[model samples]
Target: MSGAETEPGVLVLAATPIGRVADAPPRLAEELADADVVAAEDTRRLKRLTGELGVEVTGRVVSYFEGNEQRRTPALLGSLLAGERVLLVTDAGMPSVSDPGYRLVAAAVEAGVPVTAVPGPSAVLTALAVSGLPVDRFCFEGFLPRKAGERARRLAELASERRTMVFFEAPHRTEAALEAMAQAWGGERPAAVCRELTKTHEEVRRGPLAELVAWAADGVRGEVTLVVQGADDVPAVSTDDSSLRAAVAEREDRGMTRKEAIAEVAVLAGVPKREVYDLVHKSGPGEATP
Candidate 1:
């Protein structure tokens, strides 16, 4: 076997700046200049970024995006097996983060090729840092479903997620997304809507989810990153008959129907719906039932 064939290749996952060109790291430029092959989500955008940085890519360039990732994986793997240093980059942020590059990484791992990263700017971290919310423990939820029902169902599934959550959203859908979040996680949930982060016209709007919904209704522009506070760890109330009645009464006061109140109270109390229903009925007007 030739020397190149005997040697294992390296896969470098390079992170590009989300907005500001200056955020691109020195190592990123070095990788782009020296790699045997550069697989980018958008070769045009990659060219533009390199121009802005005044760096010349000496390596062969190829497209590696969602549309062509599957067909391109094997060829990229072939390069790696041939001991070619393959560099991966996406249009923005880190690769494999709501972007392509994951499949290539998986393939490289399986083939026993060495893999490393040249971490740089990230929309997720940039938004979280500027959001002013608790970031000590957080989760990155890339993007919500495009359809209304699917989106709502996804939000509902995360209604009780206790970790601070971050999400990327298109400018056009910001208003609808905020509105849905308000409905699922309660209107009063604290959140921040970061727009055009790290670039000119960057704006970070922080407030209750309901207020943000109204703000977005007026319309918003630019890429958006949403940071939401986790569910409050409310102490579990007693599940006794009196507690169930109180819970039901609270929901009723909030405009819920009696049937709706009973169902919600059962969920909160971790009891059967029938038990809550019987308790609500047994407690007659002004009748104290413990």
Candidate 2:
């Protein structure tokens, strides 16, 4: 192997401030000013952040967002292989949580490149900390499905998740998303909706899911992160024929072929695939699915 290949450059995943500019770590400026290349989700946002930090990025800056992450991974990997320090920063929070950099990071690791991070602020952790929910054991579920049926199914799959859950949602969809959560998890479930965290107009609404849904009905704005209470008691995995059939039907309704839906439903519910197929067809009278 060539020396450059063996001594591949470092990939620094820097966490930019999710809200307040002061939340950016001191090393973030140093790394931004020193790296050979800086890949940003939004170059304009990076420029604003750098200005706020009173630091200038001396490296080459390139756009690296969802649209071009796949197309650009190889080029960034080349820079890493060529022994250049490449720093990656997203618009807010860490990269790859629900952003770009996963592909590049994975490629760099495959090429034996050194990968490091400048951990700072995170919306997931920030919301969780102030959520007043159980933080001892929690899970980041990212964003939920946008479509209603798909969203309901996704929530169903996580119905038994015992760990506190965190989810990101768009400002416009906040009300609808909360309404779905109320329907799936019950109206009384406790949750918190953190909006524009750490910013001047930041607000954290804590209450029952039902109440949140009602409050959001008027409309919500800014970036949103929800912290929800997990099931206090893990419910029994539904094995009833009616429950199983309904589960299969939902997936099929979402465009999955019947066979595909059965298999998926079986795996998701931990039931035998054959059973789902059989019971789904064993309707007595008006139980036909159409």
| Cα deviation of 165, candidate 2, in Å | 1.1
Which residue segments of model 2 deviate by more than 4 Å? 1-6, 237-273, 281-290
**Clash pairs (backbone) in predicted model 1:** none
TM-score to true structure, per model: 0.81, 0.87
Pull out the clashing pairs in model 2: none
Scored by Cα lDDT, where does model 2 land?
0.88
Error of 2 at 114 (Å): 1.1
**Candidate 2: 10-residue stretch with minimal lDDT:** 248-257
Model 2 Cα lDDT, one tens digit per residue, 73-110: 99999999888999999999999889998999899988
List candidate 1 segments past 4 Å from native.
1-5, 234-290
lDDT of each: 0.88, 0.88
lDDT of each residue in 1-290, candidate 1, tens digit only: 64534677899999999888988998998999999999999999999999998889998999999999999999999999988999999999899999998999999999999999998999998889888989889999989999987787677666657889999999999999999989877999999999999889999999999999999998999989999999987345479877878877765544446776677668767888999888878898794333
**Top candidate by TM-score:** 2
